[model samples]
Target: MKAFPQQPTYTGFNEPSRVEADVCDLEVEGELPLDLNGTYYRVGPDPQYAPRLGSDIYFNGDGMVSMFRFKNGRVDLKSRYVRTDKFKLEQEAGHALFGAYRNPWSDDPAVQGKNRGTANTNIVFHNGQLLALKEDSPPVAMDPDTLETIGNWDFNGKLSSQTFTAHPKIDPQTGEMVCFGYSATGVDTPDIAYYVVGPTGEIVHEVWIKSPYNCMIHDFGVTRDFVIFPIVPVVSSAERAKAGRPTFGWDGTKDIYLGVMPRRGTARDVRWFRAPNQFASHVMNAFNEGSKVHIDMPRAESNMFPFFPDISGKPFDRERAAARVTRWTLDFNSKGDTFEARQMTSLVGDFPRIDDRYAMESYRHGYLCVSDLTKPYDALRGGSITGMFINCLGHIDLATGKHEEYFVGPTSTLQEPVFIPKSATAAEGEGYLAVLANRHEELRSDLLILDAQRLADGPIATVHLPVRLRQGLHGNWVPATAA
Candidate 1:
């Protein structure tokens, strides 16, 4: 009899180890994949943010979330932690990821009462001054450089009582600021709808864009002439029950569509760009029905459950394979609709951020997605492998359908990848992607930097943190100039 060799057993990690990496010294740069020398910081926990009872976890600010301002070689933090108490904190600041506080005056009952939650939101730099949108009070004006509250935008009449999702898009051609609202609060009739505001912060139009579909607006991108919106149709009994509505069925074949319209166009102008069907549900990341418009989604997958399965580990067994990669370009011309698309299951991602650009243009590459396969109704109460993994940034050239893959790590749960350029004054072609890797319940998060240009290149630097970030909604990179 011969003795058999033993195989190495898999030891699950509790957190990613930063010691297993090296740093990139910025002084010697010749197209390095990722700069290892880039500095990392924790802006701190969001006190103003909290999640809804049964909805997916959200970055709501009851006051705890803080804003980290980076400059020269240092990081500065501003937060509501000291201003409000845990018992009186706001649920989620009006803005997602970007911290913009809520207006304390809106009479909407969902945001009223002692539990009337306010939130920290984002500051949009508009017309020399920064405009801060929130979940309460009035829109606060701030100095982008000093982050000082300069003034507030004035509005007449009570603002609509609805959960307004999606960032306001400006009509590059017309200059009108555009925004929309979807009501999940159960206060309004016919459910979801939209609106538009002027640059001075006056409500221009609020209209209902409804369908029998009962869908939520996911991610929306704006162009010179039109606003491109991605709508996800979901049928959740728990959601209806939670919102105090009755459960209804949606036709599975009714495809999702990208709503296209002029920046100031009427509801009639707001028509479906293609057939109401979205390319596929599996490929979308950080999505919600109409409640969440656009996310900083950098990568694509076939199905969310496959990656982050509930405790049961049974794949999206009920739904047949409905995801097929398709290329559809939408033109939201006010006069009519224009779309040029090709259906293909190959190019599987959208909204790629490139070197030193905002999410719209900065498809820099790299995506960190959390997949907890366990069902919300199932075993999470017992704890399990809520799915987590990292896919190397994918390079897509839709013009030619040419694609390339970069450093995809093994079974590690990661967060949104923020691109950090090599220099304090990093121009194009000198940026790197950074991510927070949790490595599947390695409960702590590890800060990692990867070569943006070379995906195959290993980690340039790794920073192990001392705390645990439950799940982050969204975050942005502030270079030294703004720090």
Candidate 2:
């Protein structure tokens, strides 16, 4: 047996595991609402082999898709690995043949020009197909029921962009999906491709454009009339990686750029707005009013990934660079001004979400995965890295700026909460929030259901797990009818 290398990436929740399970009629702490009939799908990175380079990042791992099916007041669980080309290649080799994250030059000679993505970041369900996404490569379609890999999807050969974004937005009313790809052709390339998928899975639109610079454009926003792309300071360079430096880093000299392109037009009509340097990973929602587009999100002062340092090698202070819910208004009618931004609250958090129905329209409530102020987040590797565990779920009111939170305690960690309305006619924020919570004391995890409108009151129902699975990332509640 090959001895596995011991590294910080393999400790705690990041540790690799090979566990697939199926259980039925799980025990519940309270009542599992009968109306909450759907599947909760989540994706996480779980490396199958000890890294070939002996040092690996959390983002570099094979994807595991887990689902909880709810029906008639009962819940069933199932999980499977997303068998990507890289995963299958390593599986046959009986070890890791690839190298550093997405940099191909670091790979073993035997696996030259092999697939680079693990497809582990996020999952989306549309047109009855469950697709696993990683930004560097095209989406891999998976069997939603058995969670089996079908193959990569390129919109039946219509997608020209080699890369695809994980954060695609689905319009609630039209059922259309708005997606884009940065570095669309190759590593560190400055090209971007904006794509649209229709209600029936047709490739309705696509436009190729050049970004201000090659940067990590992770998440974007979509309103009724436009698509919003924020090109921030965090950037990647294959040339720098060939010299054994960090693949991605912050360069303070680069100005943050936001490209507002019309939903029906090409790059020629795109309006570019310049803003002060900042980093934003996610956006809650956006809407188009008369002459301006309003976008709500969490913005950070500097790069949040401690693993990737700034080019100047300046030390980072997390407390000083805290991320908060903010609003950025882009006004086209202003005589001389193009944009304005302001922090909405003092509370700090990330992974903001809203009710899907109000995604591109005016919405009142939003939720976030915030650090529990009482416990205080712990840093590892001599205060060089952070966010091994997060502790609370926060709810904010965009109209009044008042908010509340539900803490899971010091030992437990909470993933991003998925919001679903109580019913079709339910008022805004009148719904349930599904949370995947892990308790460190018993090493067990649970599915917590809380009233979205009254988050501080705590979970109304808790589904005790049959096994203690490690923490996972972004999930969604798919109604039975939709699935």
- The digit string of per-residue lDDT tens for model 2 on 47-151 reads 888888888777888888888998898999998889999989999999988888768888889988777788888888998999999998999999888898999
Candidate 1 residues lying further than 4 Å off, grouped into runs, are 1-68, 73-161, 166-177, 184-208, 235-239, 242-253, 273-315, 318-326, 330-384, 399-408, 420-430, 478-483
Q: What is the lDDT of residue 23 in candidate 1?
A: 26
lDDT of 2 at 4: 54
* Candidate 1, 1-483: lDDT as tens digits: 111112111113322111211222222112333223322322222432222322221223322232434333333333322232222333244322222112122223444443233223433443444444432223444455444445444445534544544245554334456665543343223354455666655777666565444443434565433455665443323344334332322334455556655556767766764454332432221112232223233222223323222222334532232222444554333344445445432433332334434222322233323222231322233223333333445544333455555543444445556567777556544666766565443445555556656644756656455544433433445443432
Residue 154 in candidate 2, Cα distance off native in Å = 0.8
Query: Which is the leading candidate under lDDT?
Result: 2
Task: Report the lDDT of model 1 for residue 250.
Answer: 33
Off by over 4 Å in 2: 1-4, 333-337, 376-389
RMSD for each of the candidates? 11.1, 2.4
lDDT of 2: 0.83
RMSD of 2: 2.4
Alpha-carbon shift of residue 402 in model 2 (angstroms): 0.7
TM-score of 2: 0.95
